[model samples]
Target chain A: MSGDHHGSSAISERVRHVEALLEARGLVDEGEIDRRIDEFLAGGSPANGARITARAWVDPGFRDRLLADANAAIREVGLSMAGGLQEQRLKVVANTEDEHNVVVCTLCSCYPIALLGPSPAWYKSEAYRSRVVRDPRGVLEEFGLELPAATRISVWDASAESRYLVVSRRPEGTDGMSEEELAGLVTRKGLIGTAAV
Target chain B: MPDRFAPGDAVRTSTADPTWHTRLPRYARGAVGRVVELAGHHPLADDRARGLPGTTQAVYHVRFAAADLFGDGDHAVTVELWEDYLEPADPSGGTP
Candidate 1:
């Protein structure tokens, strides 16, 4: 979303260099990469995660299944993550009245790209990764989420094999809202446990 | 595969270095935590990244208190770690 493409050309050029190297070795197809990029651009976004969270909020049975077997449960909603090499298995951690959960990747930005679309720049930034691990509440404060003093927080550090999703507690006074409307209230920050839905 | 630790068992992450590809974060080295759940056996990404074949290990969800890792916080951070990355947190032996 940076308006200055020129400022990012260095990073883009590095990516192109890697792509060229792989193509030269016949390890990857340029056409396939383009197609996958197109699909990701079209289908990947925080909206997919918001949809899953909304479904879980309304259907207790689905919530149970989602928490028990996230990969299988997502398929029921017509969503199957791309799995092969470098696949990420998802784990859903719920928030309750006494506890809240947040997700991070301290080593690197190992996130669920297929389900959550792409990770935010802040999520991948060194400042977020290093600070969130040491001071989660302070980091959340920067995101404008001030939890109750007594509410326990748990942070999930995602890895290459397993990614985490924080299921924010559904907001009150919207019990009668439709699923679509509820999904609209869910944001990427909420899924990451930095804000409320 | 035999499970070295079960759910709710207290365990400590090893400080050993695989000297290869690893998913274990530096922040979690030599940390004490509890096993929350079994993530089943899978090919270790550390081994897989090297183009090696047929090596696998059990993964577990381990919970470490925020205060334990960073020395000041009111939270916990749960991480999924490979089996070889953990050891029993013996009470007699000093832990980091």
Candidate 2:
């Protein structure tokens, strides 16, 4: 019954029509669609959320503000940080160079919606969600990040109440650097807890 | 998802009604452990129900070493889990 709507194909065709117009006007080129989706998969990196997460990590004051109210703090820097939202809030996490951070709903794919856009497909896959909690060390190893038995693995379950984001630690060589400089050191994987410094 | 289970609230799997969501691993199905902290509760997170905006209501945490889970290892990794997945253990009981 829900199929009653004319379907998204109509909308898609209209969008393609606009794309053709923009291309004809020299505003865009062919294959831009492929490039765009690739960008989206890359943690929406072009949006510069990683930079924001990293800045919050270096500055305790900002970090406090972000954790308290992730959406507002993120917006201050001009990012639309949404928590596991009906578009409600935002939450941030810090993943230091030495220490890594990864989020798993374990129950569902509850992620920091605001700072980061939609959750990744792999994030929502049973392979990741099931394995991480049961064997954190093993799963991380698959990502090519093997931590010593001593290094603790903290997996936060992103519930509906509060959204969570990984505040990746700044790179080792970045000291006394400006906010812009520090932001450059941030990476999408760093935000998800696979990489560090 | 309250005082019923803490971070290390010695518990085993509840085979009684395993139909809903569970945080215990396949290996720790019958294992018992203690809760260490009280991770707040949220809606149930199930994948079968996609586009499910909300449904997670579970308190999470580090489940301390359960004798049964890790055979001979003296030290066991802490397993975080939700509360509805656990129940109070009987001193003499192992699985219930």
Candidate 3:
């Protein structure tokens, strides 16, 4: 049900109408919208997030900086959330032995698109948006992620301008792994906190 | 406007459900939570959504216990909220 196409044509139709209106008013030139979309999409991917997470796993100082000030720290890795006119605020939360963090936007599909690429289809689904906030543990279980009963879960709802990223705990036995090797272990779900790295 | 609340302050979200657009989600309305961090000033999203010149307001990361929000849970939930959406929590007012 992730990419459920129900009512999508209606949305696309409405969007086309608005785009046509804008174009006719000279507000946007022909092909400008598609070009901008392509440009933005080209700049984003899960690799950017994985690279940042791998650096943090190996560097304590970098991890501290990233958790303290994500926007500035991401620049150190040559990644940015400044894809739009106003840069969305980024806050990186780390999972710990006793705590598990998950990110969700209950209102809409607000996400760190520049850092983690486009959101997964499930992320924007009504089931996720409604249930994650109410039953995060259940939702995680559905995602095949099960934490200890004692491990406290903190669900970060992106209801404002700030977007969140979860820095899952570095896996054990990976101390000898190189940064690139560690990065290879990261997935979009891990960054989104729906799975452990 | 000047920041009305700081990190660690207890606040309750306004329960008012405006017919127009608002960033204050219905699930959070009237709930009490403690401010975790001051996320700096951002334009009031509700006003911005209405095509008006929005005023900047302090946004905070507020933490709410999951048990309190959803009846029974051992976890917690955090939401970034604007200053206009919150008020100082009344110590005597029982949880919503």
Instruction: Please state the CAPRI-style docking class of candidate 1.
Output: medium
Could you tell which candidate, 2 or 3, scores higher by lDDT?
3
- Candidate 2 lDDT by residue in tens digits, B1-96: 235655435676545535544444455556566665554555554432354675455555544442455454323444455565667775345545
The prediction achieving the highest DockQ against the true structure is 3
lDDT tens per residue, model 1, A1-197: 11222347888998788889988899898766787677666677788888899999999999999999898888988776664354457788888899989998877787777667778888887788878878888898989999999999888888646777878889998899999999899998888888866
Q: What lDDT tens digits, residue by residue, belong to model 2 across residues A134-158?
A: 5667777887877766656666555
Kindly list the per-residue Cα lDDT of model 3 for residues A112-133, writing each as its tens digit.
8888898898888888988888
- Candidate topping lDDT: 3
Q: Largest TM-score belongs to which candidate?
A: 3
Using TM-score as the measure, name the better of candidate 1 and candidate 2: 1
Where does model 3 exceed 4 Å of error? A1-7, B90-96
List, for all models, the DockQ compared with the true complex: 0.74, 0.10, 0.87
Model 1 pairs whose backbones collide? none
With a 3 Å backbone cut-off (N, CA, C), the pairs that clash in candidate 3 are none
Alpha carbon lDDT of each predicted model: 0.81, 0.58, 0.88
TM-score of chain A of 2: 0.64
